[model samples]
Target: MSLAALLDLRGEPALVVGGGAVALRRARTLLGAGLRVTVVAPDLHPDFAALPVRAERRPYLPADLNGQRVVVAATDSEAVNDAVTAGARAAGALVNHAGDATRGTLRFPAAVERGGVQVAVSTGRELPMLAQALRERIAALLPEPGTVDAWAARREEAVRLPGAAREGALDALRADIRSAFGLSAGGAV
Candidate 1:
């Protein structure tokens, strides 16, 4: 499934089954979203030593999957990734495998961030390269950072309105924001 389709990682426990660049990148994203993260590997990239999360230096064990809400297997070895995926699934955790998307329950998306707005793109596991290419194109078409901040402020104001009024006002504000960005009304900003 698409990354956006999955549950939010905020306040959840996520496990990364590697400590290389790929795993580090994945862990960074999860941590950015407020997930509690644990990195398991024999060695970690030097950059990880400065992060505020837990890092366990060791081989992967099935017990590491316990109490995790989401798991990302980003080891260089496909076998290790697959093993982690299996263990994660058995523990009822959603998993994303960096080596092979089809081997896991979820796939990461190429995302663009603007203030409080985040637009993500994915083609399931069918064409990640294509999705990434599209993401770059979309990024180029986005508005300046200030515009996104203004939109977020408007959204917050809209949220204070009553039910139907909130929805209607938010929709209009969203349309105006998209228009200012030269994006289609229904397109993600």
Candidate 2:
């Protein structure tokens, strides 16, 4: 089973191999995660020109995987995606073949971000639609968007606790969050 964890992609480099809608979506997602994105494609959709990425208007080369923290194969061509997966494996980079999740090292889940919190739901590549539905359901439990400011304001006091005390503090925060969002102590709405 794939372990769930948050990766800090800020300022890290990643590659996306494609020029079409799938690649554009992946590129935007990566950018939103704060990764330095580079998109490789021979002919890009006009929308791609507006994105903040190093646009390599050419066929994806194996060398493009070198030093990348992550790589995504969003191309429609299965052969090209296979080549990208191999290159990424050799380079020790995590890869996601968006067209065929089972062929890649990782899968991207449907996610919802609210202020300082993020929830990601996955179905192990077996059911993306279910994951998306679950994400929407969880999103309904969140407080209003601006409440992150209240959590941020409490950050300094929260982090001052010792490591051993953090768990207890987190429990308290969880209770506070529950109260803020009208959730019961058992976490039901």
Candidate 3:
């Protein structure tokens, strides 16, 4: 599923099952989106202690899944990760299992940010390596932040135009944006 389908995690209870670098990255991402995160792991990076998050220095337990909207399992131990995934699933919370996308309820995507727009791409556990590569290429081809703003500004005007005229106007705007970014015709970033 696309990240857009998930509800905004703001103010939601989220759990991370590790305190390592991988888990830290996930925690930072969730925190950036305004989730109330709780990290459960025996050890934590020193930098993590400075972050504004709840930390529990203990092995993960089923109780950790309580009241969580999302769960991320990034622990070093595969067995623990599996257990966390299972527990989160049993709780009906969306879960992302690091390095085990097939077993998790959701997979995080590499996102491209353009002004207020965020484009996220996923391979559905089929080709993550390819997805990463495509993400880099898409990042390179994305128009400047101003272009996105311009597009948003023109959206209302386009909607006011007649049907065919609207399509043509949007097409022209898309072409101009793509050309400004040096992208080929019919190729989307």
> Which candidate achieves the best lDDT against the true structure?
2
Model 2, 74-164: lDDT tens per residue?
Answer: 9989999999998898888889998898888878899999866799999886798999999999998876777877766665566787886
The lowest-lDDT stretch of 10 consecutive residues in candidate 1 is 1-10
Query: What's model 2's overall lDDT?
Result: 0.87
Task: Give each model's whole-structure lDDT.
Answer: 0.87, 0.87, 0.85
lDDT by residue for model 3 over 1-189, one digit each (tens)?
444464587999999999999999899888988999999999998889878899999999899899999999999999999999999999999999985888898777777776666667788667878878888888877666787788877877888899999988888877877788777769653
- In terms of lDDT, the poorest run of 10 residues in model 3 is 1-10
**Candidate 3 runs further than 4 Å off:** 1-7, 160-189
Better of 2 and 3 by lDDT: 2
Using TM-score, give the best candidate's number: 2
Candidate 2, TM-score vs. the true structure?
0.84
User: Candidate 3 at residue 18, lDDT?
Assistant: 96
TM-score pick, better of 1 and 2: 2
Better of 1 and 3 by TM-score: 3
Clashing pairs in 2: none
In model 3, the Cα lDDT at residue 120 comes to 75
TM-score of 1: 0.78
Expressed as tens digits, the lDDT of each residue in 67-107 for candidate 1 is 99989999988899999999998888989989888888877
